[model samples]
Target chain A: MSDNQKKLIEMIVGMQSPEAIELTKVMLEEGADPNTILDICRKAMDSVGQKFEAGEYFVPELILAGDMLERISELVKPLLKEGGGGQKKTHGKVLIGTVAGDLHDIGKNIVTFMLDVNGFEVKDIGIDVPVATFIKEIQDFQPAVVGLSGFLTLAYDAMKETVEAIKTAGLRDNMKIMIGGGQVDQVICDYTGADGFGLNAMHAVKFCKEWFGVKE
Target chain B: MNTATQPTSNNELYAERVQRLNDAIALRQPDRVPIIMNSLFWHTRHAGLSFRDAMYDYDGLSAATRKALDELQPDAYVLPHPIMALGPTMDIMGYRQLKWPGHDGVSNDVPFQYLDKEYMKADEYADYIFDPTGFMLHKYLPRIATAFEPLAKLPNFPSLYYTRIIHSTRSFANPDLVNAFQTLQKAGEEMGRMLGKTVQFIDDMAALGYPLAESATALSPYDLFADYFRGSKGIMLDMFMRKDLLLEAMDKAAKLIPLQAIPAAKHSRSKGVFIPLHWPGDGLMSPDQFKTFYWPPLRKVVMTLIENGLTPIMFWEGGCTSRLEHIMDIPPGKCVYFFERTDIFKAKEVLGKLVCLRGNVPGTVMSAGNPDDIKAYCKKLIEVAGKGGGFIMDGGSGIPDESKDENVQAMFDATREYGGYA
Candidate 1:
């Protein structure tokens, strides 16, 4: 990587928003490949994920880093389209949303952002999503992984209902289903009939990556 | 030596309950480990009241809460007042912070959901710091509540000293501003009625021989800023970008909270100040960030409360395992450290001698698991954390709304069976 590109990654990881955005603009002005720059941003996010897992970083750092990546991607997108490299490759597709009866979306939003930055095509159907909407979106999006998120205990019944609906529709076998957010455990997972459960955003990412057979 | 044998009078029962809780708070063994039922919506549900009815009808709320307390019969119970239900008060003021049941397309059974957003922008810190009262009157209140929107048009009132007072007073005559003031008056009256009901409920519950766990609540200044003004994302970013301004705002809030919390606590039936911690847990912010930004201002508020002889009951909401050591700086036996998800065993080991430990039976068990699950967990909590006293049996985050009726009964039964002291 060029020195500017490396510095851009460092700034992004450090959560220096203006410095990272300015550096991205400078790198683009210097005629760096937009695809290479995007890849470098992903590389920085990988380091950020590692730091978070290692306890060196926390939610604030992750949020700031994600924000920087988003701003940097906005700067790089037009350039990619002009260079005829608009269609990007993703590891796999992941569909995530907060289940019905639960309006909480912070955890789901964080997981969605993490998945997007980690090179997955993430479709966030938004919060308080009905089970029928999930089924409709799944048929249309045809994702490899589906994540159900809810923070309230009442959402356990909602999750079970959704999971059962998914099974009745014969859509369970094709995709790996994972449930998360708010006190999810083996009992909840079994009750919801999800394949597995994740305690945090990184766990959700790891499950998606593992199911897709992608090694980080 | 316990009230289970039937006290001669309700006053004796009340005194016994008070002593039991005080002994636990002082890190001494009472007759038994006091059990407090901290369930919110579960109370309404147990009484067969819809969430909407509980919020709107004060009589229904009081009856429902009374039914639950009479059936459960714990040492202490969180008053199921309409303060949280926001019944008529929500519509009176046009409050914009939360979406509640029976309003704005929400179903009658749903709980109120707080809509978290930055009510105050990043650039408005200077405005807030210079005059928080003026800032609230001018900017913050207007943004959060529609009724106060016209107050934004009124000139800064602090400048209205001499002839300026006459000039400023005229602005209140504006039809819109007049309407706003009248609406505020109605809101105040509604709040008065709600509080009256709450006081009556407390008295009725106390008459029936139950004590309130907390008389008043104080919000951590950091949480006040994070929840109402800056929002979680905005405040988190502020820690990195505008650390000094954030610190200044929190320092200002430290002084403001005790002004209300102390006086309210003094007038109430209990001496505990319930402070529910919204942020500053292990995964949300690093230990260093928590130490630098979150803890100091909070510690200031806590210390002030302790100095005033009121015990501060801090409900640490999330997993704060890393924050255990940092929080031990408080004076011993002067506070209750209630953990929602923190490792209570570790908390007991670290803070047992210093502070009373309450809670951490998983809400998942209370909600989904059977009575056996609750009994075994409570048995273990009573044996371990309840050893030598200073532990109160409670759910990790109170009993969940969907918690099984049998499981809640099991929790109460387990406390009596396993929580006695020699």
Candidate 2:
């Protein structure tokens, strides 16, 4: 990596604003391919996710780092498309969203970042995503996995409904469903008929890896 | 030796009662393993009162607590607090009125107004820590007034002066601030005496345990100072820049707490002091941040309580079994952890030998379900957590006010039926 690419990686890791964008510009000027820059950003974020899992970092830090990565990805996206590197194969596709009636997004956001780093093409549908959105996204993305998050007791039902809707739509066999959040439990997961349940962010990653039959 | 025939004296009875509870804890063989529903606001509400009423009325408070105890009938009575009047008042004055989104009297929206836009900006921090009384009177009080317009018409208008003075000391000039803080400390000592006396009266009559005091784990001391004293945005900057000052402030806060807590514990005649392990869970602070920012002060507080002859009951808010091993270092049996989302089996497997374990019942089952559900759930919890003796039964978090009284009764009934010495 060139000095600018190194600096861009640091900026992204440190979640420093303007510094990240400026470093991205410098890397681009240094003849760094936009695809290469995206790769660097992804690597930097993967390290952040690892640190988070290892207990060296926290939610705010993850959020900050994820934001920086998102900004860098936005900057490099056009370039990746122009370079025809946009169609590069991802490990798998994931459709992740917090269930309805739950506005909390921090947990969902962390899972999204972790999946993103693990080479999963994560499509985060943000907070309070209705069941219909999950159905539509699964139909459109046809992602290998569907992850639902809810932090409230009320939202657990929404999670169950979402799962039932997916199954009713005959998508259960094709898609792997995972559920988590504060109000979730093994019983809830079984009742909801989700394929798996993750107790925390680290567990979510492990669940995904196992579900996809990927080592590590 | 008319021990069998004559009625037992209060002291003898109280001691025997406490001993029985401790024996259960020690032997892991509590007859109907004691389950304490450590609810903050709900206990008060269940007594047919409001937050303001519970804070001030000792008799009313004691009565409500007694009622709950009679209703639940756990093997032991763990009194987390007869009344935690301070933080809630500050929360109401600082942010919005407190609300209980769930049972367990968990107070939400502990708000703080920011003194500076950037908390870590040392240059601007002084401006952020100004006279809170005037601010509360001018800005927050009016808001409270409007919110409680009907209540405002009542006599003896409530004032936020105390909370302002308590929170505003960081902004004062050195010598004045020091002198002011000393005077405040003396005043607080006096207030502690009064609070203690009130608590002691309750203790004498009810024979209850101590009040459990916990903060959300997401709140580091720095977070508390920033969120409760400074604004969120400002505190974020403060964490990066004025890190030293933030640490110093936390140390100071930590030191001050024990002074009042000791007296309160004495007053309540409590054997245990409950401190919540909130932030070490998955989505909040990492274990690293917990070790760095949270663990030290918490250890200090826990150690102080133990040294002063009080047991430390740690309420692990979300899943904290992952970090229970780290907590084992804090002097065993001096602590009893109440878990919410943690793996109880793993906790029992790991920390069971080290400290007493309480809780793991899902609040949802108690709040929304029937007695049979509660009975079945308690039976399962007892089978797992009740194995060798250091386990107590409780709602996973707290019993919501809306929870069916019959469900609460069923929890106690199940404990009696299944949680025996055998």
For model 1, the superposed segments whose C-alpha errors exceed 4 Å read A82-87, B1-6
Candidate 2 residue lDDT tens string, B230-258: 54434443444465666666665566556
Single out the weakest 10-residue window by summed lDDT for candidate 1 chain A. A81-90
DockQ (Cα-based) for each candidate: 0.71, 0.20
lDDT per residue for candidate 1 within B123-241, as digits (tens), equals 88888889999999888889988898998888887777888887777887899999999999999998889888888889988998989989888988889989999988889889888
Best by lDDT: 1
Separately for all candidates shown, the number of backbone clashes (residues 3 or more apart, or on different chains) is 0, 20
The interface RMSD values of the models, given in order, are 1.3, 6.0
Residue A67 CA error for candidate 2 (Å)?
A: 4.4
The CA root-mean-square deviation of candidate 2, after full C-alpha superposition on the true structure, stands at 9.3
